[model samples]
Target: MREHYRDFLIRNWEKGDRTRAAAVISYVLSEYGLGWEPNDADRDVLQVEEFYLATGGEFWVIEHQSQIVGTGAYYPINRGEKAVEIRKMYLLPSVRGIGLGKYLLQQLEAAIANRGFQQIWIETASILVEAVKLYESHGYQPETGVETARCDRVYVKYLD
Candidate 1:
């Protein structure tokens, strides 16, 4: 991979990041010929902190040249549950093949493990071949019985 984004910064999601996050999400889905669904609307991007941080979870954004290029988050599946659900991980085409996705996944995994979670679940579309490969490469295994109607693939990783 070439060194294209030397100034890339990965940080926790904060106030006022919703607009950029939403744009990145929209762009990625549209690029893949997908549209916003009910699940997307339910997320309420503007209240990320409330939906993630306030619920013993976290959301992060990757910024390059002061623009948000990627977004990822994990939220508790349920109160008192030892597992969390990974959601909304998206990256722009310009930064896709440079290890940023792996970096983001690693960071999110570390954060989730640090919080004492044992299992991490992720739901994604079957058409997102790169993402599936990324997760499998990092030790995420495919699992059955996913709950989301919007996504067709489910994966789980158990932290050591």
Candidate 2:
């Protein structure tokens, strides 16, 4: 971790970022005792092109000191009309609580709105208390029908 959390850079994924980005996601999930399996819970991570970039969506990589430390992304989903689902929003333990998560989330929201998506949906596990609070604090209202195997909660927010 660097002293300047704000010094990191967020950019569209490159073909070479696949492994490092997936590792970042896996490390963060493991910190909470969660499991990640390629082509399953992490299928989109494995196929970033097919699941995201090729489908009118995006996946971003956050890097600090030349190392990838976090990831955030979204993709259009069938959950709601003109809606997109936020996925793979993970920050390493060392980078938590420095406002980076909030910044990254805002970036995601802006992209969604810029694309004319009417709303944003998020599915997460209750054990990830920080993420739960982040979404709730940002006005993502609680909802039903969490489709992820490890998630027990859902939140959705309509764009203005």
TM-score of each: 0.89, 0.95
lDDT of each: 0.81, 0.91
User: What's the lDDT for residue 133 in model 2?
Assistant: 96
lDDT of 1 by residue, 1-160 (tens): 1123367888877788878888898888888887865355436566786788788888888889989999888888852259899888999999988888988888788888888998999888888889999988999898887676667988888877
- Runs in model 1 lying further than 4 Å from the true structure: 1-5, 38-44, 79-81
Q: Please give me the total number of clashing residue pairs in predicted model 2.
A: 0
Q: Identify the runs in model 2 with alpha carbons over 4 angstroms from their true place.
A: 1-5
Candidate 2 lDDT score at position 27: 91
Q: Which of the numbered candidates is closest to the native, going by highest TM-score?
A: 2
